[model samples]
Target: MDNKEYKEYTAADFLNDPDFLLWCLDPDKREDLFWSEFPANHPETFAEFRKAIQTVGSVRLNNFTLEEGEKAELYDSIMSDYRALCSRRRLLRRRLFALAAAAVVAAGVVVPALLGVFRPPTETDASPARASEIRLISGRQSEHIASESASIECAPSGEVRINGRKIASAKPARMNRLVVPEGKRADITLSDGSRVWINSGSVFTFPAAFGEGERRVSIEGELYIDVTPDPERPFIVHNALFDTRVLGTSFDVNAYCDSNRPASVVLVHGAVEITTGDGEQVQLESNDMFSLKAGNYTVVKVDPSQYVSWKDGLFTFSSGTLERVIAQIAAYYRVEIVCDPDVRELCCSGKLVLFDDLSDTLDVLSDILPINCRIEQRPDGTRAVCVTARTN
Candidate 1:
């Protein structure tokens, strides 16, 4: 049977799963599943359990106005610079969207093949190629990647297309970043027929879509990739902070810019090369986890299972410092974490699923670690602090 015809993992599997496909695709639902325990595949899933919680807990409710306030602010900020131009004028100049007045739909010219198109998530302003168009729909968050003549097809091989042009093909890649939100993750099959799983609150961009050549893409945040076996492309990852070049492997990278030290790359299988700007370069084989600091590269042998924990649909932290654990949770949940030095230095290693509330996460972290965490209500009314009081 073709890959499309295959019975895949069901919706229920993804729903109860912290790392299940559900949480990766929808950011809004994460808060609902953060603390609930579901079946876990490995230590990695354990990590994501608490990670999901910490992420949601970090959402600062302070100073958050209603959606209407947000919309008004957006309009105020852009109206001056956008008052001109016919297309721009109609959309915002008349507040057409607010008035529920829109008629840009292309009737006859619209192609049937263009429906339900999926484009890559964009950072900040999605400045799409001048030739192509990717727009945000009103209700659903999918970037409506509409192109006139270009037809997009996912071959039996799971390869994707734009029109007839092959923007990404099977190939080894160097720098690939595919970003997924709390409720979304994308499956990208590499040229060598390897599959890369991008986790939520993470991005996986690879030359995996490359033609017959070396593959690469720079990434920010977390990702899980199963590299296709290719001697030539030797799938590679490039971050402004670090680099990982590998041949036929599966691995994960936690290399966001906010990371205190260098980003980390952990290999589950295959051979790889990791280079840190601090002049530290090393080759990693299976079961190796490497990280870069300002100028230092640290390599260690890991269970490999820990690195690919996100792959199992959960995140787990081994006996790590409280600060370190919190950092990972903060990024996943997209929240700000604050802890004093005394409590921050405390070490913790335990298993918990992602938490939906910061207060709840704080309670759990406090229960497991030698600290008491609480939210300090600010003058603005929304509690902003995840204060940790050292028990020691």
Candidate 2:
């Protein structure tokens, strides 16, 4: 294919391309170099290319043996089915290709049960459900705070207070969990004087007081933390994929544990050393962002404000695609947002103040971009914001 043709290819087009299939099936050094450089050369098609790669990589062919002739026959059959399906419907082509790819090289009969293509979307696949209130859990006791935003304090004496009212008193070493539901935010002052601003849909676990050894906390969503500088006791933040260690510095950690999103750490100041699940350690300086995707780590320089601004009820982006911006809004408000694929890749730049009302924020976004936003009810009994190209 020519450069223009390759640049215009969608995920489905890439999956059905003979050259792409050859590279996936029988990779050579030349093809590896070419595919690796394709994204850099055609930035517009990078997302589609990445989607194709992930779809292909996730298919697992198990322990089925087939004769050479059988393999050839099965491959031809799968390709024929794929082509027939492609000609019928464009919306279902990717899912059909996934099933075809699974049985193409395998000798056994195609089994739809073994493929993930037919699986329904799980809870993680959708926007997190909005909880009625934030819950703080300590041992068997749970405290529910009904406020839109909450401020919790943990005193050195093992006393916990929410919004200046004493909630619970426990041992200094007792572990406590704070849950911030969607459409809300919270700030917590740890016993050691370190403060953390937790974002929506986040779960933060920390001890009521720091031990003599090291201060440690674990988070599943996102948070902006300012560590109390104590060289003797380094502060560490743990997530599913990696651990970030620092001393007396501020940084933003976005470890949402979502397959579609990469876990990243953005350093606002000071420095941090990240230890991956495989024990690979990387150090980051100020204004540096470290992102981990598919077991690989990448570091880049970015404006710290673009990431940490959420702590101040602001969303900032520069040349960010509409798809990503909508994803962020969906997570923040716990609202399902569906952006038209035709306009998903459109890029915009601006700062948006996240108002309490989601519509207010959407209004600002619609004004900034050439898009129209409307709320619609999905078949699943939930409401969603649908974004399409502006007609007027």
Off by over 4 Å in 1: 1-177, 182-187, 276-281, 340-347, 355-383, 389-392
Candidate 1 lDDT by residue in tens digits, 1-392: 01221122232233333343233333235433542434242333454345544443333212323488878876884574355534553333223221111111111112232212112222332122111232222122233333211123334333455333445433232323333443233454545566665544554444423656666665655677777677866677777677788877788887655534456888887888877766567898888888776766788998865456544434455555556666655554454566565555454443443433445445545543456655556675433446455555
lDDT of 2 by residue, 1-392 (tens): 44436745655456546567556655568877888788998898898799878755744433457799989987996587667667665323333333333222211122223211111112442133445688888999989887666778999899998876797697898888888877778899999999999998788999988889999999888999999999999999999899999988999999875666788999999999999999999999999999998999899999998798787666766667666678788877767776666566666455555655687568656654567999877797766787877887
Error of 1 at 239 (Å): 1.6
Decoy 1 TM-score against native: 0.52
Candidate 2 CA-lDDT value: 0.74
Instruction: Give the count of colliding residue pairs in each prediction.
Output: 55, 0
lDDT (C-alpha) at residue 44 in model 2: 84
List ranges where model 2 is wrong by over 4 Å. 1-130, 345-347
